[model samples]
Target: MRLASLSLRYKILDFLYKVYPEAVEELTIIHVFYEYHTVDDIKKHLNYLVDKGYIEQKEICLRLGTKKTTNIYKITSKGIDLMQGIIQDKAIPIPEDE
Candidate 1:
């Protein structure tokens, strides 16, 4: 899938993986995108991540008297291994000043 080729998906997956232990509140993703995009963009990107199996979906109740609807992503082990390789392969070593 071309979706697998996009770097943005990787970024989103990395973010989710890093935050998986936390609650991953909805607003957290919005804050992550504040500099360049809107919350809608993040939501769309998250949907793509869901389709790619890098993230999971779950309904969450954000408030009382409202139907619970949210995508809670849990990073898969395969995703962790993939991200680790990507990070390692792309890392650039910094030189120390003598």
Candidate 2:
């Protein structure tokens, strides 16, 4: 899929790709804000990535006493390949001077 057309999805995938190795430990509420526009937007974007096979979702228990469930996402190999292709293709536009 075209990265520009899938801008939001790509952003989510990029975040997942960056955090895949330490996803369980590094991801946090604050990180979402630093990386994305909003929580609901990120959620919707991640859902699209999940549907497209770019990301895998897992439910992890964050607390022992209550077994609080948290959603953790990781990028697939296919996602990395796609991201590399997009980067190589250089499909993103450079802004023009106003």
Against the true structure, what is each candidate's TM-score?
A: 0.62, 0.65
Candidate 1, residue 62: Cα displacement in angstroms equals 2.4
Find the candidate with the highest lDDT and give its number: 2
lDDT of 1 by residue, 1-98 (tens): 34333545666666776776554655666677656666676777777666655566676876788986664566666556556664222221111230
lDDT of 1 at 15: 77
Query: Residue 42 of candidate 1: its Cα lDDT?
Result: 72
Give candidate 1's TM-score: 0.62
Instruction: List the pairs of residues colliding in candidate 2.
Output: none
lDDT at position 18, candidate 2: 75
lDDT of 1: 0.59
Q: Which stretches in model 2 have alpha-carbon errors above 4 Å?
A: 1-5, 24-30, 34-36, 86-98
- Which runs in model 1 stand beyond 4 Å of their true positions? 1-5, 64-69, 86-98
